[model samples]
Target: MKTMRFTPPGYGGRRRDPEQVKRDGWREQGILAVSVDDERLTWPERELVRQLGDRLYGPRAADDGGRHG
Candidate 1:
């Protein structure tokens, strides 16, 4: 299995690059297409997608240590 890593562009407190954002969006669209065609995800792939979603849209609480001042 191939490994994939997702990093938000310019994630370390820098402005994101528009080209990188477009590339990432394309990658995400590809994943969505595959998921739709396959109709089900393998366990590991499912977990990876879940984690990615969390990174993208998860809740942030004060005690989670991810809150911005």
Candidate 2:
């Protein structure tokens, strides 16, 4: 399973690269997507994963599945 390191801004009082953060966040979401289905995780954990996905990717309409609608 792919895993993403949870390194947020201000880690060790250092500056961050926006582009890198975006890339990492996307990868993190992909990993979380798989992790969310893991039976080992509790309900709250799964909920948190869902919330993160929502926050990172935002809501999607049925017709807006990647193309101009």
lDDT of each: 0.57, 0.63
Give the Cα error of residue 4 in candidate 2, in Å: 38
Q: Candidate 2 on 1-69: residue-level lDDT in tens?
A: 977577666565565686566567778774322355568789998778766766887744532556765
**Total colliding residue pairs, candidate 1:** 0
After superposition, the stretches of candidate 1 with alpha carbons farther than 4 Å from their true spots are: 1-39, 59-69
**TM-score to native of every candidate shown:** 0.31, 0.35
Per-residue accuracy of model 1 over 4-57 as CA lDDT, tens digit each: 476667555566686566667778775342231233677787667656655876
By lDDT, who's the top model here? 2
Task: Estimate candidate 2's alpha-carbon lDDT, on a 0 to 1 scale.
Answer: 0.63
Clashing residue pairs found in predicted model 1: none
